[model samples]
Target: MTRLSRWLGTAGALALAGLATPALAAGTQAGTTITNTVTVNYQVGGVAQNAQTASDTFTVDRKINVTVAEVGNATIVVSPGQSQAVLTYSVTNLSNATLDFALTTAQQTGGAGAHSNTDNFDTTNAKIYVDTNGNGVWDAGDTLVTYLDELAADGTKTVFVLSDIPLGRATNDVAVVTLTATGREGGGAGAMGAALVQTAGANTSAMDTVFADGAGATDAARDAAFSARDDYTVSAAALTVTKVSKIISDPVNGTTNPKMIPGATVEYCITVANAAGGAAANNVALTDVLPTTTTYLSSFGILMNGTVTGAACNADGAAGGTFASGAVSGTLASVAAGAARTMLFRVTIN
Candidate 1:
C-alpha cells in the first residue's frame, strides 16, 4: 500500500479507538489523513487475458485554514428628491483559499433611528438586478439577489440593494446584510461538492467576483469606475404675454377732402410686427366686422401690386372701407422666423 493509504488506515483505526476513550471530552487532538488511489483492469477476447494495475496514491490531512477580510463598510444613500435608496456593499477575500458567499439583510432594532422589520425593500424586485443568468435581460424568476461564487485570494465582490423607502424616513433606516463565506483551503469544491467543481471549475471563480475584483474589489473603487443612480426635480417657471404696436397705411390718398367718395374704390394697408423676444405665427383674419354706419358692397378683390388695382373699394367720401359678407379667404403662408408681412384690403363703403 502507498504511504497515503497506510496513513489513512491508521487514522481510521485511531478514530475508532478515540470513541472508546474516557478523555474524549478533554479535547484530545485527533490527527486524520486520507488517501486516494485509482486501479484499471482490461481484457481481450478469444484467448483469456487478465490484467491488474494500481495508480499512485496521494494523502491529505484534515485542517482548517480560514481567513476573513472585509472589503469595507457598505453604504446606501438617496438623493433628496427621490423616493428610493440605493445600497452598495463590498466584501474581500483575504484567505489563501477561495470563498463563496451569500448576502442577506436584517432590520435594525432598539436604536435611535431604528425601523420596524418590514419587507419594504426588495433587491430582486428593483429595476436594476445583477443579471445573474448572463442573458442580457431581467426576468421574474431570476429574483434571488446577492450571490457570489468564488472569490479568489485578494479578490472582492460588490452587492447592490434598492430600497423603496424615502430618504427622510428615520434619518438612518439601517439594516444589516450578512455575508456568509464557505469553502475549503486551496480552492476545494466547497459545500457545492464535485459536480460544481466540474462545471464551474476547481477554482472558486464566479462572473460577478471577477467583475468586482477587476474593478479593484472595493465598493468605493467600483463606484468610482462606474455611474450610480442620480435624482432630479422638474418644474415649470413662468408664462406671460405682451402687446407691441400696430401699423396702418392708406394706399388711396386723394386731393379731395374726406378722400373716398360713394361708388369709388380705395386700398388700405395694415402691417403688424412681432417685437417680442420670442416668435409667434398668427393667421389673424382681416374681417371688417363693419359698424352699422357702413353699408356692404360688391366683391372685395385683392391687389398684389404696390399700388391699388381694384374697383371694389367704396368711392364714397369716407375714411375707412367696407366689404361684402364672406368676401375674402386665404392663407398668410408662414410668418418669417423673426420678421413680418403686410396685408392689403380693397373695398367700397356707402
Candidate 2:
C-alpha cells in the first residue's frame, strides 16, 4: 500500500477508466486517499525538450457495512440450577476497509416486540468473549478481549456469549442474550489491519497522531453502519433418580430362581435418570441407604451406565460403591438428558 500527501482539490478533479489488461492491486482500503503524479516530455520550438509533472488524488469508496448473527439460532440448553450457559455468534467485516469491533452484551427481560421470546428473567454476569481458539467450546485458556483486532472485508470471527443463569429455573424456562458490536478504526495489530498504536510518520508532530486501534475517529462504523446486534435463547436442566431391589441369591435355592428369604443376597439397583425437556446432566451421583434388616456386601454389584444393556459393567471406574454403618451407596459419573443410568449394590438379609 502507498500513502502520499497532496494539496486539496475539488471532487471532479479525479477520473477513472476501464482497464483492458490485468494490473497489480495495491491492496488499498476503502475511504483511503491515493495520490498519483504523471510527467510528460515535449519539444518546444523544435529546439529543446522539456518535461512537466502533473498530479491528482482520489479516495477509495467501497461499501461500508457489518453483520452480527447468532450461530445456529438454536436454543441453548441449561440444566436445572445450572449457573452458566454459552451462546455463540459471528461478526463479519462487510466493508472494504479493515475495522476493529468492541463487544457488549444485554440480557432480555421478557417484553413485547423483538424481545417477546424473553421469559421475564435475565442471565446474570453476562459477558462476550472472542473464541480465540476457533473452537466452539468455551475454555479457561481463551482470553477475554475488549475488542477484536481489525477485521478485513468479508472476514468473520466467532465469539462466545457466556453468562451465569439465574438459579431455580424450571424445565423449559427461557431467557434471551443479546450481543452488540461497534466498529473501531482499522489498522490494529493483525495481518489485515493496523497496529494498535500506529507508527510515527514523516514529521511526527506536524499532524495529529494516528490514535490507537479502538481510539481512532473511525472507531464507529461508516454512517449508521456503526453498530450491529444479534441474540440467542437459553433453557434449563432437570434430573431425577429411581431405585429397585431384587433377590439375586438365596441359601435354599442356591442360584436358581433366587428367593427373598433370610440369608438371600439382594441386589439393589439405583437409577439416576436425565428426564426430557432439560439440558444434559453433569457429575451425577446416586445415594441409597440400605434397609436395617439387610447387610451390605463389599463390591457386590455392577454399574450399567446410561443404558441397561450393550454398555460394559463398572470396569472403567465410571461407577462405584461405598458403605458406612448400615447404608449402601453407588453413583454414575454423569447422565445426559433423555438418558438413564443404573448401578447395583448387594445386600444380604441379616
lDDT of 1: 0.35
| Model 2 lDDT tens row, 1-350 | 01222222222234322233333231335656656565555787886577755576556554445667777755666654445477777877665566787676765566521334545566777766888887877788666766678777668898887777667777656776666655566454852333233334543322122321222112343331333233334444466666667777799997999899999988766666667766666666556777788887775554545355443223233445667766655556667677777776678898
Error of 2 at 176 (Å): 2.2
Task: Give candidate 2 regions above 4 Å deviation.
Answer: 1-64, 78-85, 95-98, 111-121, 131-142, 152-155, 165-171, 185-237, 241-273, 277-283, 290-320, 333-350
Per-candidate local distance difference test: 0.35, 0.59
lDDT of 2: 0.59
Residue 339 CA error for candidate 2 (Å)? 6.0
lDDT for 187 in candidate 1 is: 32
Judge candidate 2 at residue 101 and give its lDDT.
71
Q: Can you write out model 1's per-residue Cα lDDT over 1-350, one digit (the tens) per residue?
A: 45555555556655775687654221222122223333434567755456443333222211112222222332443332343344444444543334454433433222222122222222222332333444434344334444355655455555444445433332223332322333322234333222112122342222211122222211232211222221111111111222121112223543344344554444555433433333343453444444343333335444211221232222232232334564432334334333444445554544
